[model samples]
Every structure is written in structure tokens, then in C-alpha cells.
Target: MPELSGPRSGSEVPLELLRTPPPKERADAARNRAAVLEAAARLFAEHGVEAVSLDAVAAAAGVGKGTLFRRFGDKAGLAVALLDNRESVLQEAILYGPAPLGPDAAPTERLTAFTDAYLDFLLPHLALVRVSETASPGARYRIGAYRFWHRHVAILLASAPDPDVAAHTFLAALAAEHVAAVLPELGEQRLRAGLHQLGAALA
Candidate 1:
């Protein structure tokens, strides 16, 4: 029976005793958190990251502005959380999705799968994807995926005429997206074709 009024309402209550909830949450906290994240994602997607403020997120989520800051620390932290949420989906597809993309395929096949998987997964996320690419200490959302592709290609390159040369070449080729940003003419189909040719050459 926690009182709904001023500090004196629970003044007689012991600190630890009042801190404990019957079930740790009154149900509203969990709902509010979910609503907040969902609203953040939607708003961030609709409006660019910089355009969406904490107050807007709170209004969209139906929570107080204080709650948003408390949960996410700050705007950058909120952005990172959104990126993490997106990466989790991509991780599941690559690590546990269909054949070739997952672990069951042959090395060469997985290499191709890696290229295709990234193209498919990353294309839709291009909007939010660019945000993490800029230099930031905690901006590591893409590192795991990039490392996985590099590791897979490096393994396949090990048996090549010059493994070192092949691995570096493969790495350089896979970095086409960075170039794609500069070259607007390179569409998705051409990008995939280019990656396939590069993979074939490295393999």
C-alpha cells in the first residue's frame, strides 16, 4: 500500500521495505520500456536521429521525459540501443538462418553466402547503418558482422596461391559499400555482381 502523495506518505516505511515491489514491477514499468523502445525506433526511422529529441520519444511512448533519460542515459545511448536492436535481427539471420548463410555450408559457399547475406540484410538498414559507421568509441554494431565475413573469406583464401595477397584483396573488395556511397550509379544488382566476381577471384 504505497501512498500516491508526498514524501511523508511513505516516510514511516523502511527504505528497503519500500524499495521492494511484490513482483519487482507493477506491470507498467515493463510496458513503458517496451513502448519507449518501439517509439524510439519508429521516430528514429521516420525522422533522422538528430531530429528526434528525448521529449518527443517520451511523448511518442507515453512515458515521462525523465524515464527516457533514466533508461537510455542520453541521446547517443538511445541511438546505440536502436542499432543493437537492429543488429540482433541480422545476427540471427546470419548465425541461424537458412543454409549457406548459417554454418552448414562449405567454405566457398559460405563465402558467397556471406556476401549475399550482407547485401540482403544491410540494404534495408542502409538508413540506420550509416549512423554507426562514423567514428565513435562505442559504435561497434557492424564490427561483429564485418569480422565474421572477414574470417570466412580469410579461411577460404588460406588455400589460394598467395593467401596473404588474396585475403587483403578480398577485404578491399568487400569494402565496396564505402565506395558505393561515393558512386551513385552502382545499384544493388551491380553491387551483388561485383561482390560475386570479387569472391570468385579470391576463392
Candidate 2:
């Protein structure tokens, strides 16, 4: 179990774990990586994430399939690489920035703020986010970044009965696949509004 404690708890996973710096790479390796990400992004945007493949990305990047596989492992890993910077920024805000997302607000308010910010993040990148999340069965649960989000929300819900379960339930409502399915019907505004009801029932 993740240590449920204050922000600076020694047992807590380090924020550095989430905001990892890119590994140093030789110029050729770095170029290939940049080229791969650029090509993948363009292809994903144009054809939709589900419609594209790692092979397509590799061909677009002019890198060999072997290189793409070695560098990113798969399409999911490539999506994750593309999202790293934005995820790091969001993590930084939640940990150190300001009220609501930061530690300064009341728990309910913070959770609501998280929902709002996260919806904004999820909307534009829905396709890619879904790809990263649904790469494999239970892939979302296994992601390191998912753990960070879970821990943060679980901490905020610390006063509840089974904050762990509450956190998981709340996050279930925001899963990329679920959101994608509901979005066209609910649309962004109603969708976000519905999600804002995190329910004092949990409290």
C-alpha cells in the first residue's frame, strides 16, 4: 500500500519519480526519438490513434520498425512519451503550485478542482490518452503516473471510509474510454458538470 501521509512524508513516493528528466542520449538516438514522437503525433492527429500503428509511425519517421520498437516498446509507450511533459506539469501543479490543486484547499474543493483540470487535459488528448490507458488489459492501473494520481486523490479522501476504494471509484468515472463513450452525448460542459458531483456521499 502507498503510505498515506502528509505531503513531505518520507514514505511517500518522491515527486521526482513523476517529473523525471529525459535520459541523456547520443545525438543520433535523440534525433530518432524526436523524429518518432513528431511523426507519431502527426499521424495520430490525422488518422486518429486507433487507426494508426507503430509501423505507420516508424515509416513516417523514416526510422526502422526495429528502432521504434526498441525506443518506445509499442504504441502505448509512444503515447506516454508524447504526454510526459504535460503530465509532469500537471503533477507539479498538484504537488507545489497553488490552492485547490495544491495542498492549501479543503479536500472536497481540491478533488473538484482536480476533476475540472483533468477534464480539460483529457478532452483534447482523448484518443491518445485512451491508447496509453487501454494498451493492455488493466494497463491504466499499472501505469506509474496513474499511481501518482491515485495516491494524491486517496490522500485527499483520507477522512473517508476506505480512501483507497473511494479514490479508485472516483477515477473510474474519469477513465478515458468511459469519457470517450459518453462525450458525444453529454458533451464537454454537461460531462464535466456531472463529474463534479463527486458526492459528499463518500464523506
What are the clashing pairs of model 2?
none
Model 1, range 1-203, lDDT digits (tens) per residue?
21112121112332122221222445787788779879988998798766888899999999999988887767655655565655555555545567676556675786787777666656665555555544364343344444434444555555677654565576655443464474367777787888788878777
Cα RMSD of all models vs. native, in order, equals 15.3, 3.4
lDDT of each: 0.60, 0.81
Per-candidate total of colliding backbone pairs: 0, 0
Give candidate 2's TM-score: 0.88
- Candidate 2 stretches with Cα past 4 Å from truth are 1-4, 7-21
Clashes of 1: 0
Q: Each model's TM-score?
A: 0.62, 0.88
Candidate 1 has its poorest 10 consecutive residues by lDDT at 1-10
lDDT of 1 at 4: 18
